[model samples]
Target: MSEKQAKKERTRKRLTQEEKAKIKQVEETHRLEARALRENWLNLDNAALIYPAIGSTEWNSVFRLSAIISEKVNCDLLEQALRDTLKRYPFFNVSLCDGLFWHYFQTLSTAPKVELETNYPCRPFTFNRKNQIFRVLYLDNKISFETFHSLTDGGGAMRFFNTLLARYFELTGVKYKNLGDFDLNVRDLPVEEESEDAFHRFANNGKCKPRKETTAYAIKGALENPNILNVVLGSVNIDALKECAKTYGATVNEFLSAVYLSVMIAEKHHSNTKNRHPVKLSVPVSLRRFYPTKTMRNFSQYLNYEVPTDRENASFSELIEIIKAQSKNINIDYFQQMFNANIRSERNFFVRILPLAVKDPILKFVYNRVGERLFTSTLSNLGICKLPAELDDKILNYHFILGATKLNRINLTAVTFKDKCCLTFSTRLSERRVIREFFKMLTSFNLNVEIISNV
Candidate 1:
């Protein structure tokens, strides 16, 4: 390569921060203020009903959202930034109150403190008595936000984290002219849209589809410190993953889901489990993609794809085929059916008339027998995180970790940024067979897989 040609290539690749700011100017225009309203006692949305009934010290239904920035975290600045961010997102700063018939939310008068994290990810929320549903942690150069599932899902959590980052940057004198979705200054309004219950908005009084229950293959091994969470983060090259998925004619999620199912089947065969059942993967489908709403609450549903264990020897292509077809069918109509099912149950006269004490155990029983038994595990992909050029350069990467459940010991989540797709596995059981075989399969596909474990 000639020096002149090399110089030209280098110049094109290294974009100045100012140039980065100008590149995404059009996206900055999409930012608009939202109209917000204050409410003391608000009803739980359709999706949040089951969480409280089944929640315990062990299965708290919480998740953690963390970011790796270029500079060290400043606690003072983060504290103030959170105070300001909560003003705009008041729905998150509330405590759960038990009602006669339902669990309601009451806005807290005081704000929760931001502390440095010294514990494992997805710690049980009941361990603290502050009554706040979410808490922020700072360590080294990272900022972590942990929240109960009843408060929100991944989409809402991302909004809060992004907004907090933007405000922190401003406080540190590093101003971002426009951070795209990460721009905190642009969405500075108390908009009702932010707190809207989207499931209620898109549901109807249609006959709910009766869900069929089937036993799925469960992973069993030494429980080992059952309370401890085993985390393995695999950073895969996005370009290579995309190319591999392209050849299979599947999305990244579909391809990874297939890969995950393959690992589970292989482990089952290795263990020589006598009775085999259908292997089901619980995939969360975000409702915001279909119906437009800015509600920062739980507005997502799960789509379970089951492959019979008798067909454990099926080719990767065959497993992916089933996944692609099932995932594609989860369209607007499918979501409506799911939303209506829950709404129908909530609207039932007998169910509504039942006392809270009577309803809790019934809901818990149904969840254990049907809900928890329906799927083998969960694979949730948060799509991709895109930020303005300057901010993107400053961020090392982002992670999404779902809390492990009593029935479902392992849960996997993926989020992409720039060229890296971070796939995180959170589990409670001692067996590393599933996670070990998962990355091995990725390497078999000739994709570069880097593993980082927080055990």
Candidate 2:
């Protein structure tokens, strides 16, 4: 070794007395602060309050965000990246803890384990003791993040995932020129607004009227084993899909929602079960654009597009027109009302004082009887995802997959990256007819589609 290198190693190995004392002091202070955090608890946001009460051993609201990197992932580097990423999102380093009247979050004593992917995606958290609500898994070149819905909505999860990718890319020495455009740096510290309950912040002052929910027609099929999750991904050119949507005089989201409703109608017709109810697609709209916030938690609401029973036989163009008419709800005021309705209930004296034992069963029953029944299926489009220019070809693809619930046997999610739009369908139904029909609709437009599956 060179003389300069040998001297530097010697200095690192043998710290001076002053340096040692300063290091010890810093360590002690950090230890105390961490200890204090371990004892403290955080309240579940207005939307997340029901998850702890309603989540079951069989099913829970889980969502996954994944990216297939161009090269095989280095496990050691991915682990290091996770540790560094959590520092800027301390809220993610937490466990769901049960309390007397409500459930809460507590920072974990240590970080969560990063493991190799083996089991099905979005497996239920045992929640035996201090289990974190989120998990990170890597297999081959793909890095997948699965989290309980209570943890964060798509906007929050995307930021966290993108930040981790930025750090991972930096570690791999690939610098992206457009990295500053999004400004999601892993080196930054946590800010107060990142953990704020934005639902409460943007709620309207007046008692907003909550819209009546429809008891929509449900997707029926032979159930697959509860232990398994089936995911089918269909990829198409974003430009081609957009052109098709444009052909129908519809936006991408409206076009997709219309296609989903058409599938539900066809399913009903083929089954002949005589379910003539409205087929509703629960479309989750991110509130970040309307009510800006930096909170890394759930802050999105659903816009139900219920197909009018009278117009059930309408052509695809007619369905698109129907959806376009309902697009009026895509506004600040509509979401404000949705937010207000939930926040007001949370503020109710009775709900606030109820015991956990009494609240849990009631919440579960209400969720099953109301929430699940109000929507036939869900269609969430993450608009368009942008990454740094250098990372354009570095990421092979992206997928946004939702977990299976008992009522909604199949759900669809879409995400676009670098002009490639991936439409992922996750389901527990062994029946693949609906999936086939959905893709058939796409191909009928002469759009070339490549399919992938983990059935």
C-alpha lDDT values of all predictions: 0.83, 0.87
Question: How many angstroms is residue 451 displaced in model 1 relative to the true structure, after the best TM-score fit?
Answer: 1.5
Considering every candidate listed, which one attains the maximal lDDT? 2
- Total clashes for model 1: 6
Please write out the lDDT profile of model 1 over residues 17-66, one tens digit for every residue: 78868866745643321112224667888898888899986668989888
Estimate, for each residue in 197-258, the C-alpha lDDT of model 2 and write its tens digit. 89988886776756577799998888877889999999999999999999988889999899
Clashing pairs in 2: none
**Model 1 global lDDT (CA atoms, 0 to 1):** 0.83
* Candidate 1 ranges with C-alpha deviation above 4 Å: 1-39, 127-130, 179-183
Task: Give the TM-scores of the predictions, in the order they appear.
Answer: 0.89, 0.92
